[model samples]
Target: MLRPQGAASKKVSVPPALKSSRGVKSWKEAAAWLRARGIEDIECITPDLAGVARGKMMPSSKFTSNTSLALPSALYRHTISGDYPDETESFRYEARDSDLKLEPDLSTLSVVPWETDPTAQVICDVVDTDGESVPYAPRNVLKNIVALYAERGWKPVVAPEIEFYLVAMNDDPDYPLRPPKGRSGRSILGGQSYSIAGINEFDELIDDIYHFSEKQGLEIDTLIHEEGPAQLEINLRHGDPVALADQVFLFKRTIREAALKHGIYATFMAKPMQRQPGSAMHIHQSVIDEATGKNIFSNADGTPSQEFFHFIGGMQKYVPSSLVMLAPYVNSYRRLTPDMACPVNNAWGYDNRTTAFRVPLSDPQARRVENRLPSSDANPYLALASSLAAGYLGIKKEIEPTEPTAETANEGSIDLPRGLLEAVALLEGEPDFLEVFGKEFIGIYAGVKRGEFETFMQVISPWEREFLLLNV
Candidate 1:
């Protein structure tokens, strides 16, 4: 029989600053916080590997108690299809369902604006019974990566530009999605590039989005109509990497819920429509010296530092191998086609959108690198973690970048893995990636994706019947 191993579990420690000002470390503090907000229920949420919020709902009293929330440890092992892989030690149904503790991150407390009742929600970190973080948990993966930066007295500041599509609600996966009709009684055909009227077309829904985001403390900066029909983008204010990730997770959920209320569907599927441009969760990243609280990538005189080039070099070297994390599914690869806004390779350039990494036009304090490879569907936590880890390694090694590109990267200028399997193969070959992300996580992630790939191959695509069957 499988057994729960509590003896090896370590206690979870909350940072002093968090405990004092932001996080609730004791039940008494949690009770006070809930009582002050008049919150009757608490929604305990954990972001899975895919950044899907999964957890339990409980009364505020229970949430404020010493009792730890227990959920199946296998929650981390599910494939994108939401099914367990075959007969693995960690994922098999035959294995006794082990429980992991879900501790609420008090800093994430916010009222659920859509809920009629006085309900609040908090994000959680999955940990072992003894309180050690689950190694395979996506949030923990990011936490470990952040710790690596902290060791070198560096802190990663990140902001995410999240893009998605608002479509008519559809239940069938086989059916194509369509843009929802706006207030003008028509759906956009094409070319809404930052048009103010386009935003007003969906102002009702956008108003709700802003309302919910404000209530939930999302710190959303801008809302714009993107390049494609019904495409939308929301930018979150930059801060700590972990905090920013939490905001992204919550923001995505908030958008979906708000869309539903307005009788529409909000999707972050990278390539939802073949004719429209793909959605991406581009991350803007910069590092600060922990002790000095200054941007490390630039000098006091506002000149680029050697650390900046190494950071860029790190991204160029590691992004190829880390594509599995940036674009996890088969559909994600479709978004990386040439000539699209999305870059096909890990090329870096200044103010050039065609490159995978872009040095945005900003002053010394605000200088940052934008990683444009990650699809909006990619897990925000994992994507940010992978990018930061690579850049940190580059700084550690003092890697140098190539000359910055002055023009758009030409067609076929950079080679990239063409498929999910190819990306997985590259990841497996990159020892540094495997070592940095952890063998346990890499194994589970690759195996689950491989299983998903096999499932996908078993199906006959529509193209087969439309052309191949009659031709053959």
Candidate 2:
């Protein structure tokens, strides 16, 4: 899978070709306007549980005042391969191939910078012909999660810290050993991670990324050369979980598009390199009451709040099950190797890095739990939704987490599944992940993940090529 690497130092504004077309304040007017921009085509995109966009593009001339498109009602019912069965099997057993009405979500319209023709992008909601949200839509899944929180006068604020790398591929397999741009030597092209002095080596690449990102409104929170050679992480401010997920989807493409425009490649593989700290999307989560705007996790008498404990307890209680959604991809399991700043166990500690979850030493008013197990390969939508679901379970059951331990490494952290199969089993066995994410999502998700696992199983890797070619 192609993954993004490096923090876009900033997000650029919609380019000139896109400047006049901000949020589609009016889809009808915007559609008409786009039709006049010499646009020969428009593509409607729907993101799947895997965070991959899938949908059809249509000729611009045919779009009229009341244009409506039909997508597979089962579109919400499949894996990334477009490989789901009909009514005889799976989630939409009753619905079959019914059309899901496509209505434009105007804010999502943007210029497809890489497209050859005059093309614009639009994201749509999956609705039945009756115009109701598809029950299994990933977007709707988050909408439902948000509504659940709203009912309790709470808001779940989530922040995503993304890590990616810059790479260059060459025709000769050994050529990749050189710096991507051919600038290799005693120079620190891809040396030690975040060495303050060595950090200057890649300033040009980092500078261009930040500039491009600034113009795109990514609202970048922070950027740092992380603890990996040529690896970096970008932080975004806390936002509503649904929007945060969408941002992550767009953010992935933004970095990729920008990096390519600058002659570099970005990757988000959880453990791209063997001996370094793996990329992680550690989530710092907390809840605030919508009415008072006061953080419910804040302790009134100057101690850790009970509400806070319940939330962490909720997350910790079902983490093993949540791992299926939290770390969905096969490469995700590789990062669970002990002591790589990637977690092997499910332990939470105060200001500690070894634990699976952690409480930062930052101000108490800003206190939050850091979920450290999720790999860089995790999908933002599924990861966030599953987490909310598990945390809610924690609140409902009022579970208390065992105290954080002083043991180093994986001594006391909860064990994570070693592969996609185990992760799927974890999801299936735990009622929290199953019920919250729903059986349909579980089925589709497991199906796609299993497909990926199978693909990996069939392919022989370089190590195997060398180690077992003759022996096996």
Candidate 3:
């Protein structure tokens, strides 16, 4: 699918109509707010397919007047390793790698507390030369899914619990990561498992995280020490899916920044250490009637509504095909092993962590489902989009679900993809997935993921050398 090289193109203007409607006035107001804060640099960030922040830093003076900036449209298609598949067509080089407009979401403006300089950041969307959203952009993909709910007068509320690890700083990838020494001058031992003292060991770092989160306007609800050493989990307050996704995107960056300031490394890698539980971005979701402002998952009599069952049915029907979006990387599958309390099958249950879909204990109004399959490395935007879309499809089609499992789902027989390659194959021709996430988008995404998998397989792992090299 390689295209012949073409001449370089200059600026691509935002469509005049879109510029007027999509937060143009808000951007100017943001510019004024930055000036008032004496912000010198503005980091304009767009989320790539991998949810990594990719963009340029510009002087505040330029950002104030220009409400729009341009970047290569192909930026969204890059793999985690910064390589591209030869067959990619979403942002072809034949288009001369043309500039796509970046329109800032002024509401995402936040002070960069970690930046020593007076700097701020604003999230932006990649807009085509036609001024419409690029369909494949992660943020735009999520917005489209959210719009589907809006059309039905229903809204999806999401709360994300992201688990991560804090390890000692090391430059060598081959070296094993270990928990860093906290303020008490002792490294964390294994199996903290919600110990209050375990969290207090890193009080200084955790406190700084809260302070930074406040400055950034992140509404973090709770922080707890997880099962693994130096592993921590933070829950973001629930709200609109799009807004929650934005918070997750920014929260990851902020935590890393805070960890660096404290001379430790915080990682969201799916499986950072062997024999340790992997990090996951468990998403808790609920639907509400936009007009009545009441939950749609529960009836007035405090009983589970048909919509709730259908939503679960939708998840069971579509989640197998949607695994590529939730568990995107090779390392992601390593975390899905059975008995780790991570999901190994497409099972639904009440208050059961082993099941992929969990209906947590809550009052009638607070009722919701939690998707436990997403790794921390997964893109929050894509993860949320796939989940909300699946639930919506269930509601629309009224799909019936299997009986909820009363025990561990891993003990049951329902099978899901066991690896990234298998996950890609499952997603390859899924009509339900293709209908929700366009064909072009899935094609580009799958190609990139498969390319990454091939790249990973080429590497000789330490385990292979240690065990198989001599034994085999």
RMSD in order of candidates? 9.8, 8.6, 11.1
Local distance difference test values of all predictions, in order? 0.85, 0.71, 0.87
The TM-score ranking, best first, is 3, 1, 2
Where is the poorest 10-residue window by lDDT in model 1? 14-23
- Model 1 — TM-score against the truth? 0.92
Model 2: per-residue Cα lDDT at residue 13: 57
Question: Which 10-residue window in model 3 sums to the lowest lDDT?
Answer: 16-25
Question: Mind giving the per-residue lDDT tens digits that candidate 1 earns over 1-472?
Answer: 5447765656897544333323465666667767766888888999987889899999998886666787897777777787776755423341577898898887777788899999988898888878888888888999999999898899999999999999998898778999999999998766998999989999999999999888776788998999999999999888999999988898899999999999999999999998679999999999999999999989999999999999999998888888889899989998989867789877889999988899999999888999999999999999999899889878887888889987877466556788999998887778886557887888777777776787788788777988999799
Provide the global lDDT of candidate 2 against the true structure.
0.71
Q: Residue 86 of candidate 2: its Cα lDDT?
A: 38
**Residue-level error in angstroms, candidate 2, position 59:** 6.2
TM-scores of the candidates in the order shown: 0.92, 0.84, 0.92
- Which ranges in model 3 have alpha carbons more than 4 Å from their true place? 1-25, 88-94, 412-414
Task: State the lDDT at 23 in candidate 2.
Answer: 50
Q: For residues 1-472, write the lDDT of model 3, one tens digit per residue.
A: 5555895556886444232211224655665567657889999998989999988899998888765688886776567998876765542432577888888887777788889899988898888889988888899999999898899999899999999999999999889988899878999987899989999998988998999888787888999999989999999999988888999999999899999989999999999989999999999999999999999999999999999999999999988888989999999988988867688888899998888999999999999999998999999999999899999999999999999999767875648788888888878767777767887788778888888987898888898889997798
Q: Candidate 2, which segments miss by more than 4 Å at Cα?
A: 1-25, 28-42, 58-64, 73-95, 111-119, 170-179, 182-191, 195-204, 407-409, 412-414
